[model samples]
Target: MAILTPGKPPRATSRSRSDARTRFSDRASAWLNHPMADIVLVLTASGLLLALGSIMVWSASTVFSYTQFSDAFYFMRRHLVFLGVALVAGWVTSRIPVDRLRGLGWLVFSVAGLLLALTFTPLGYGVGGNNNWLNLGGANSMLRVQPAEFAKLAIVVWGSAVLANKRRLLDQPKHLLVPFLPFSLLLIGLVVLQHDLGTAILLGGLVVAVLWCVGAPLRVLGTLAVLIAGALGTLVLANRSRVDRILGFLNPGSDLTGINHQPMQALYGLATGGWWGVGLGSSRQKWGSLAEAHTDYVLAIIGEELGLVGTLVVLLLFVILGYAGVRIALRSSTFFGRLVAAGVTSWIMMQALVNVMVVLGLLPVLGVPLPLVSYGGSALLANVMALGVLVACARDEPDAKAWLKRRATLRSKAPKRRFSAVLPGRS
Candidate 1:
């Protein structure tokens, strides 16, 4: 009867585990306290996207750029220049306070609105049937700038400020609808006049998202959305070409010789791409089979050469980008910063969605570039600049405490050198 039980191991208590966790967390925090985490990740992702985009741009545009300009790398070179400028601008912007950005929002909106108005004047240039570009005279005589691009960015800033200012009254439909409806419609009308139904629709969605996120009532948003949808439907019906596009989308196979040619060809390109793709630079579709193969229809070219896998990769990159953007927006401390980051992310991502959807026959073809991967000077620069804003917001986030500490250290050390010379230094 007298077998003695072996002594049992002591169980871990909540206090002991809590202490261990606290110690582990302290160590982790120490590591993270060296540089901004969100900023580094954002910058890294952005750089990856940009680098991949550049390579793909060259691949996408080599034939077209060569044929159109007699220079094999014209578009690529131009894109590089824009990339450099945007990077500088973004870095500078990151150093500035978000509060300052709030002040600039209204000014930016007003200035961009003016520029949009100027596009209707003689100074404007019509490109590919859309008169939405301004000709800034110089060595870049043909240098065209799309005011709508700036307007989108401005809308983010202005909308954030508007929402912040009216936080209390957001639930009141009258106050919310009265100011936003007219301001938003003015921009949409101007874009529609430019014959850019894509941008117009994109802007409309953006305004609605911003308004909703800021706490606009569901009924108010729903009613306005229906009205906007009806108005847009009427506008499309009024235009014969718009009707043709919608029809073409619905039945690409039926109108091969007429309105449905582009979408039909795009679909064919996708089919030929099969599973693994024909291999890079070997797309028969790019050989004049599909129009605008490097720009609006680049996804088709991707499918043609890179296959389903490559297409999926592109989609995955976008998904990752969207996730990162939303992460940054959520982490942002200030309302303006959060909205700005969210709006820019949504703007670029939505455009990418429209481009892919149109190419894949899921939506009506409205000419929109595929963000960074598409070949277009205006689109490329504008998009990079928008990404820059996202980077700035990420850099300022709370998790970036480590990175901010390093920056502070560097600032302190740098300033000591400046004052050393004034204190009767050896030099």
Candidate 2:
């Protein structure tokens, strides 16, 4: 028996506490299992990352913009314009019918391939020694595009369509490798010729993901992995700069002022940030200490200014985005949808992992920008459009479709307000 104080309330018993916890857990599980959950999660996570990206881009680019363009907001303004364009594109993509994508996949892939091929023409230009950019308008114009970015999406859509069609025939190696392997190799070879190994690696990963989703045998996958490894090794050995970076990664203390400068500076920025960060825009690294502060090294700036907590938040958002993508893939009714969802999820997550690892000095500099967070018009546009496709897939899930139909019915049956219904003396 327990005695209660005269003026104090009695404490809750363990059984009551346990019951409360059980009820809370039940509610959470139900909410997570709701038909609308995956769609909501994807949209929310993407939105948060976009918002944060805008903020970080503005913060990280202020110094560089002011120095080069004599305007602090130059990059930010450009980023906003790109953001607006991307949002509109994403909205349009989200409305596109999933079934139509299959029919249009080849056309999209062909267009992307054409654009990529044009990168070697007179209109093509090199950036950071990689001839992977196409300059539109005159040479002085700012309207440049990276066809490799769009190629990522093209591969996902086209590869998924082809694999999904050959589902039954996938058991035969010839059927699996005929068209898909040839086309994928062509795109990857184009990217490699431009010396953009990072994009090539990503394209390769997409191929692996598509094949795995279609149930390729482990032995075949193992052979492909070895081939990819050998190719990458050969590519690395072919370039002195690439070899230097590899050596620098292996021996961090060898070249402080050369190949290791950027990595070391990134580490310094992260170290300065400590736990909470040095506070947004207060980063010392952004003040001429860090290169590509708004692009490839933006994560370093994020760590410098926002600290570990901020970095963790960004990571958590990616995790949520990845989780929603997987959920959508699992719930999809068609094999194409599954392959697409899985492909996009792998693309984003793998890119994010690579970027983060590079910034932390765990890997050599790969020039891979942090998706959505980095300041690149082409990348931002491509990523958001891909996300829109993911959302469309989520909506096409059987349960989600039923829920949406029910919602539409309810919305249609609801009473609408008349113009003068609420006005005084109006019935």
Candidate 2 regions exceeding 4 Å error are: 1-17, 139-142, 420-427
TM-score of each: 0.84, 0.95
Index of the highest-TM-score prediction: 2
lDDT of 2 at 165: 81
Error in Å for residue 37 of model 2: 0.7
lDDT winner: 2
Off by over 4 Å in 1: 1-35, 138-142, 401-403, 410-427
Candidate 1 deviates by what RMSD? 7.2
Query: What are the clashing pairs of model 2?
Result: none
Tell me the deviation in Å of residue 420 in model 1: 18
Clashes of 2: 0
User: What do the candidate models score in CA lDDT, each in turn?
Assistant: 0.78, 0.92
